[model samples]
Target: MTATSDGTPKVAIILGTRPEIIKCAPLIKACDRRGVDCLLIHTGQHYSEDLDQVFFDQLELPTPDYNLEVGSRSHGEQTGRMLEGIENLLEAHTPDIVLVQGDTNSVLAGALAGAKSNIDVGHVEAGLRSFDREMPEETNRVVTDHVSDYLFAPTEETKRYLERESVPGEIVVTGNTIVDSLYEYRDLAAEKSDVLNELNVAEDDFYLLTAHRAENVDTRDSFDRLLEGVSRFAAQTDREVVYPIHPRAQSRLDEFGLAVPEEIRTIEPLDFLDFLRLESAAALVFTDSGGVQEETCILGTPCVTLRYSTERPETAYVGANCLAGLDPDDIVEAGTMMLGKCADWDVPFGDGRAAERILDVLAVGAEPDAAEVPT
Candidate 1:
């Protein structure tokens, strides 16, 4: 790892999942352009090379300088291990600042470790709230934002959320780096990927489905309901339902004795580029993932969120998304409604310059120390 120097400070970029890899690509490039020495660190929360390698290759992201290999575990265990690993790394590298994106446990771990080390921490996609504390992501975001020295919110709503909390960090509404990445790579995705052809799915010929939340997968009833919903939708619409299954979801499906239907194709998880192509061509998208919710809105694809709520409610408010709680009937109804509707809604996320704005915020000096206050 590179050390901080007088000319240019060393910046540590931390990521653990495919979403993080995609969202951080633009910011990594932005830092490179500014002559910042970037150290990419992978926490290995999601450890499949098949699932993660494509993103690095597709995004042209640098191989991580270090990989903690902190594989699957309970939420507490994973977070605890990541915290220890990241703190040790921060101590060795002595980066001027740490950059973490989104609301993963990895984000929280990186932020806390950096803050404890007295290194400034910058959080991209900060200040998002679903107002549901049961979700681990909500807790992760709350803790990460509190410790963050720089908070890069994607929307004005997010900035307001931070302001309401009286967060001391500099808050800049940088649009969304995901949008920047999507628009930057969409053309390339279209040209390079054979996902459409392989799936026998022509433009607007199929509905996309992705459900991988632990709440939904950890329960047999919930898993069965999700499968039933997809089966019903496929039978009724005669349109293909393509699900690029997360490994955990696939395991749950088997455990529940649920079979993915013939019309409902269950494929391995796709890389970032392939997934983007599928998202752009789909008639409608059904998912529980925050990243998919944001991307579907940007692609102008109507979405039916399989969860009761989403942190990215801006998509729902803009008519690009509808929350259909994990019920077979609701899923079918929402998918039907979306299939018949015209996709003309505007994207609520900003135009693709989020990375530039985020880096600009990070370039500013750190927040004031509480001890510096005068009596």
Candidate 2:
């Protein structure tokens, strides 16, 4: 780590996607509050309005110290480019510890770069598995976990997975940072967002749909099937389906010649606050994103996951989520079932203080002194 003449430890938080920015916000703030020299790196993995720039503005996060601008490419091409860019950056500005989050290709690249450099690496939100190797995210999560030196798992279940896989690290059971963000932003969403008024949709009268997972969107058949399900559900329920189209999803829609129905009004991707308000306002949510599943559970909103499997089985076990793969009939049935079921379960995630716990471990290692955490 390049030390300031005063000698405080230097840390690097590497992130490349919009979700990473959102999840990493509290940790960044903690660093600033505690006087840590934390460097932010944006690999530009998901660079667009909703996916990128708006998050920084709405979340009030500082602009990244470096933007690799390594926009979309094939998986091999994107990861290889990121690995090269991050390695070069690390050589120029060495850090004591490298922290990465979730299972994006960016996370994989960041972890690989740090390990290869012999830097101590911390993997946040570690040990999640869908058991589906076909899902690139599963591969990313598995590979990153193995190489990390500090594994900050979100739950006991995840910790067990790491144990089974024989991952070496101080696997601290810090709750998920997404819980921290949900608590941090939900109030802000209520206070500042006018999404409901702007969309002309009443609370609990719409279905919030977000399908941007590569597994769901990259293929012609799967993409067509998902859209058909959304259309079918809308036709059956006569409920307006609000889809804030992910840039990636929009491209696939055009490429595959699939059409969104009149009932499913597609809008530009929303800023974080706006999206949170919409999530609470919706009667039910249909999504393929892991982050959304956790968000839905925290918001006490019923959700129909548009994937056959989820890394977040806790949500399903708690009666807040239903798994419905890309099949149109299954999607419609699951959405219908979710609409009828009320989210009566308690929050199974965390106590909304995970960011503080995670930052404690990052700042002070496995046994964070109580004094290091604020009251």
Candidate 3:
């Protein structure tokens, strides 16, 4: 690996979705602190101003160096476009290392491009498995982990998954960077966001819902069941459910001609600060998002996941979340179970220095901080 003219490592950070931006914010900032020559590349998988630009503004990240606007498309086409665009950038810029976060198609493309170019690839939040091959994200993450030169697993359990696969990468148990992002921004969100007032909701008086995965929202049966179940739970509790609906999920609702219940309040998607504020204050959260599972757990908020399985089972293992598969009865039961339980469960993610540790390994091949590594 070669260093830049300044004798510092050069890193190309590739991301496309909201979760990736939020999770990678810390690493981006860490590069600045460490004087690493960093380049931000966006694959434009999520190209909307609402889904994409707002996150960069609210998170205080610099504008991306390049935006390959490969917007919505079939899975194969999207991944293929990303691969072409990322490979061209890799050849021209020739960074020493490529870093990708989570299990998005952009991540898969970044890893493939970096490996094909003979540049080291570092996979952050690696070694997650839902064990169900039906999910597209499962395939993306599995392939990325194998191609990566550095696998930064978020927990011992996640690291174990990599070991079991015998992936030819150096595996280090660096806790998830989402923890770092949350710890860094939670106080900022609380101070700067008045989303509760803006939405006319009170703390601990509303439920939050976010469902956008294809398996959960694309099918009529699955999507209908999810909305009905969460609506029923909200009605029984006499609390309104706030949904900052993702564009894809909203389009599905329109296509399927589904009517949202009166108890559910649908709103435009929020920026990170506002969403963090709502997540911190909501009575309970319902979602099919993996990042939200980790966030809600870290915030001590109860989550009823709207999926049959999750890659982040650590949240469920610690009693911070429950899988409510797509059944109205099951969803309501899961809500009741979580509502009855206290929100004092121990956070199992990390101590919030994951980005620093990941950069340590990538920049200088240092050992992970022993104190912060989750057992």
How much is the lDDT of residue 258 in candidate 2?
A: 82
lDDT values of the candidates?
0.85, 0.86, 0.91
Please report the candidate that would top lDDT against the real structure: 3
* Model 2 clash tally, residue pairs: 0
Candidate 2 on 75-168: residue-level lDDT in tens?
9999999999999988888888889999998999999999999898999899999999999999999999999999988877888899999988
Clashing pairs in 1: none
Task: Score residue 111 of candidate 3 by CA lDDT.
Answer: 96
Model 2: lDDT to the true structure: 0.86
> Candidate 3, residues 1-375: lDDT per residue as tens digits?
677666767899999988999999999988877677888999999988555787999888999999999999999999999999999999999899999999999999999999999999999999999999999999999999999999999998999999999999999988889998999899999999999999999999999999999998898889999999999999999999999998899999999999998999999999899999999999999999999999999998999999989999999999999999999999999999998468878878788888888887765433334254565
TM-score computed on alpha carbons, candidate 3: 0.97
Best by TM-score: 3
- Badly placed stretches (over 4 Å) of model 3 are 364-372
Stretches > 4 Å off in candidate 1:
1-5, 364-375
lDDT of 2 at 321: 96
Candidate 2: 10-residue stretch with minimal lDDT: 366-375
TM-score per model over all chains: 0.94, 0.94, 0.97
